[model samples]
Target: MNLSLQFNPELFRDPNRFCVYVHGLPEMPVAWVGFCRVADVLISPDAYASQAWRDTALTAPLISLTVTDVCETEGEAMRAALRLVRMYQPPINLRSGPVSSRSGRKVMCLETGVTYDTAAAAARANGLFESQLSVYLNRRSTGKIRGLTFKRV
Candidate 1:
């Protein structure tokens, strides 16, 4: 969705929904994809204007701030964003924070002995947050959370 300069933030008033922001063309060669609430970026003018890349792309005759998907939960939006990141492999997304690393990490459930091709896949199948899985993998601790143990494979 194209966001106009004077667009009303109320247009995306759902505080609970997660907004997926896409740079460049929505179809292909997406420069970046990140998810946040409307208040985080849209409602707050300072936050909205902080993304210099968005302004640069808009002035460069390219569409910026395309809202690709509005997910019910942050986890769902994250999963969708990770899927896009993997598919497009956009270079600029490395600056989008930790979510950018969800592309190709293999995760195995120590308790269930199930290995997932990607952290996103593991999170989706097990109904866990990808971020939580990342923490377990990064810490390399034997402790378990929610009775589930994970390790990077």
Candidate 2:
């Protein structure tokens, strides 16, 4: 028996929805799933490239996979998804808030030209999102900040 089968979410999303399939090795592909509105804040583990392939049929909750892990192996990618879900699930309360909350409105309070990959390290170092850039800017403090303009990337 496949023990991994128990961990499968069996979640599904519509085919027409905006989806991002971060390709990995030929044998492994990780699909980041969500609507366009919440493209920045939330994502779901919609599909994976296994020996057998399948697509989601209805939207499930956001799975919160990080951009940096986009290239990891299939197992690593899924573990990362579960880690992110455990990390961000409670306070953000994706299940309880209005649909708009998924748009990063309640979470991503700051914006910069910094791509997700650029600031991910700094954000992780600070134990927060890149929003700290705004804090540095507002204080007029000299910091390793970049992208002066503040709009969603």
Candidate 3:
């Protein structure tokens, strides 16, 4: 599917060749808005455990995405991440209203939790597939959480 994201047009022109970052809704740094091939980063369990996700544990009770979303195949997750980045903006606030993409894909932002499951659940409900959420989290797959283990916030 062609997400047709508008942030970095040239970089995403060829979705098959590059990796993209799209997770960390609450902590996604503004500086990460671009295309890159540095798909070597890994989001260790300890890395995803954040206060933001925990803060909304009771109210949100949702996930952002899942292991399945990013582990479908090689580079598939990257493509998904690019789709997310193209569709949404920074600091994904789960408490806000839904945002629509040019193609009419509406994604409800979620407060980032401390665990992968929570993040995935929230993102999955919004619009993202279980394919690329992990790529957005770690930049690359470490294959450590194939079973999708996460620490509860």
Candidate 4:
């Protein structure tokens, strides 16, 4: 989905990519507006205790943004995001725009809690899947959770 983020930056256009930070609602920085991008998010096996499937998907609870909506500056997006984190309680899955593309590089992933669903209707009719977005938070993960930035492996 092509969406407008709170803040548009030259760096975002770079293939190097950027990061989106999510926090607990109660722990939001201030007033946060939400954003969505198609960037690839990282997941770790011990993600929320190996709960990647639900956490990364729209099933996880809401989180706080780094910025607040009250702030209308360069980082206004960050401020808005922070406030959002403070507002929403989680187990809510939040997302940005669509996936960003690079010349020949596959985006790296860092997911933790991973769930699998083949039939969205069947999963939900059984009171299993929450929405048509077939997803769940039940799986075994042996993945790694990277830090905020990257380093040579």
- TM-score top scorer: 1
**Per-candidate TM-score against the hidden true structure:** 0.28, 0.17, 0.21, 0.21
Query: What's the lDDT of the predicted structure labeled candidate 1?
Result: 0.36
Candidate 4 TM-score to native: 0.21
Clashes of each: 0, 5, 22, 54
Q: What does candidate 4's lDDT look like per residue over 55-106, in tens digits?
A: 4433434442232122223234343343333232242333232222422211
Off by over 4 Å in 3: 1-24, 27-29, 32-123, 133-153
Any idea what lDDT model 3 has?
0.34
Candidate 3 lDDT, tens digit per residue, 3-116? 211122124445443333333243344233333333333354444465653444323523331121312333354345444544443423333223323223223233432344
Query: Considering lDDT, where higher is better, how would the candidates rank from best to worst?
Result: 1, 3, 4, 2
- lDDT, residue 78, candidate 2: 34
Model with the higher TM-score, candidate 1 or 2: 1
- Global CA lDDT of candidate 4, please? 0.28
Model 2 residue runs over 4 Å out of place are 1-112, 129-144, 147-153
Candidate 1 residue-wise lDDT, 73-128, digit = tens: 64465455445434433221211222224354433233324334443453455444
Give the TM-score ranking, best first: 1, 3, 4, 2
- Give the clash count for model 3: 22
Let me know the TM-score candidate 3 reaches against the reference structure. Answer: 0.21
